[model samples]
Target: MTIEQSPAPSDVADVYDGIGQIYGSAWGPNYHYGYWDDADDTSSIEVATDRLTDMMISGLDVRPGQRVLDVGCGIGHPALRLVRTGDVDVVGISVSHVQVAQANELAAAAGLAEKAKFQFTDAMDMPFPDGSFDAAWAFESMWHMPDRGQVLSEIARVLRPGGHLAIVDVIERGPVSPEGRKVLDHVCENYAVKSLGTVDEYRTALAANGFVDVEIRDISDNCNRTLAVMADAVETKYDELAALVGEEQATSLLAFMRLSAVTPEQGYLYLAAVRA
Candidate 1:
């Protein structure tokens, strides 16, 4: 396979727009849920994502009447889930127009038309006022962001004082060898991820941006297992995905899945974090 270079915003946008189209259909609804146990069974997408969403929500401690923002909300699944609490107003933002449209449709269907909505916008340039939200969450999407610090800064800017931010994503870890880096770079290049930082890197950024009470949780096992199961699922639906997104994209996605299985199996990593 030919390896590509680091992705631009437009490049990432195209990849995710396609992902948004087949996200629920191919991934089975957990929308790339993180893993706690590499061996945990992910046969059931509903169960896997449910556990993942619960874990994420628990960290945010979202309450009724709170204003929440979901940065990089894919199809607004988590935002929809958050509205079930009956006390939160949620706005999901995505760079992909397709995802925003789909998410809005899903939100409307779930009867959360007023409380939860998705818009097509960049996280680094969100069109919201300062102190606009009580909490912000980024589930498995920050890694895909090219400028995470800027995104974090924007998040900090929009959050109310002492507002919470919860993120569940893959983080790079110690002593990455040349080979390991190559594997990671290959996956990132093919899939259009600009960069993925370590857990400490994130803490430093959060602190630099004036965030406190930062917590990083090791969920590599969960990520690994999810990737493994998802690989199988993708393979099972390879034909359909190719039909929807073409062969090159489908192959690239499989390469992404195969790489995730390798990273955590070889090193320790944090898959999630919550900060105030």
Candidate 2:
């Protein structure tokens, strides 16, 4: 019935620690949105999410033996895919200790412990040296950052000159009406996100942090179907989710998921920039 005004890193981590596996089972390894090509496209969510990952990897322009930072990496599945595709080394960081441990286990099971490793680290204050990585990837992670600019600056600092940063994030399209704002607020609160930023705002922050050749692509239409799929999954698993988290929280989460599925004001975007 009552929502926390602002959730801290620990709060977010706790939520993931409790429901990470269940969430992964319902949504699969890739937690981000899926890309749908057409109304009749019947590709599975896993395939579409992999397509999005491939798109991000292409935007990054990474090569073999390069070190890439996977910011806010969820369960390290995307990082594993990147290493497999490009033969690159990836260091994934997450706020949740459970995620880091689970990701490491998954990496070991896939025989990628040497190529892809995950650690419990905050994106706002990453534990990496300057120019340590050749490229960076942030997938659906920026919205949880309390200070988006600070996080961007940290990513820029860790990346080498000319290194690319590719991000696929949920964004606010523009000014939202009161009704829309209510839906957005509920979604943010339920998802442990501090706030949503506009595509322009993301571009400006990247530029301010010494990033150039910024690119922003609105992919709302392609990704909106993910929310609908997620909502249906939640509805089917309502009892299980309620048992994990309280009934009130589960009901509220289902409401937010359904609203997010149909809301036009909340959108998705793909952004890329090169370190200047």
Candidate 3:
């Protein structure tokens, strides 16, 4: 199978630097999906996103003093929450300097600077040493990677034996209709996403890299709400978004929100595995 490379780092950084501001204003701090317990649950998007983060944290089985790595950490919200909830220190890495700066500022402002630190680093070539982390996670950030296997290899290398890894990402579920593919490609264009990974790809990659006890499951039902919510937010702030990312790119994003809202082929998946 041929996995594609990610967009250029500069391109990816530009994409996030603009969208991050929009996301911060619209969807609170977290840029990932929202979770709902069931049809009756009506938690706000901010709370739902945190719930998803907590869900990922729950699977890590981390200890208080262990270090955790946050791959493609957008703004360090999850890292900060992890330190508060589990008393673990986090070292978050992102390609975007804007994000690293903002995340560090947030961590400092929250008095968690020593516990959660963000840096501008590429996951494909992590600066961390072998066995540097006790646990790791990528929250909806894997798709931006140019080389999925390289990033996973780095994750595996940095994590100590018996350390747990968790990942939550959007994926191509299966057999996307041509029309759906068209929308998916358009979303990729504006979002700086090269390609989405499949569940089987993850399973194979994890096993090949000496990970064990891998478990992956679908969580789309809980996350699909994020698209519509984001669309609503973009619409309400279209002028502001246009100012940040220009009217053209901002319009494409809004259209993606509408199109991808009904695109069932785009699904969310969660995977947890232990490093061996």
lDDT of each: 0.73, 0.87, 0.87
Q: Look at candidate 1 and give me any clashing residue pairs.
A: 35-222, 35-223, 36-222, 37-222, 64-87, 65-87
Quote each prediction's TM-score.
Answer: 0.87, 0.95, 0.95
State the lDDT of candidate 2 residue by residue for 63-120, as single tens digits. Answer: 8999999998989989999999999999999999988998999999999999999998
Per-residue accuracy of model 1 over 1-276 as CA lDDT, tens digit each: 123444565776787766544555767544656445345353466676766777777777777899999988887887888788546999898877877888899888888889998887888788999999988888777777777888899998898887778888766665777767766776566556766667777878888887887777766766566666677767877887789779997888787677767775233243333334
Per-residue lDDT value at 35 in model 3: 91
- Candidate 2 overall Cα lDDT vs. reference? 0.87
- Rank the models by TM-score, top first: 3, 2, 1
Candidate 3 all-Cα RMSD = 1.8
Model 2 poorest ten-residue lDDT run? 1-10
lDDT of 1 at 108: 87
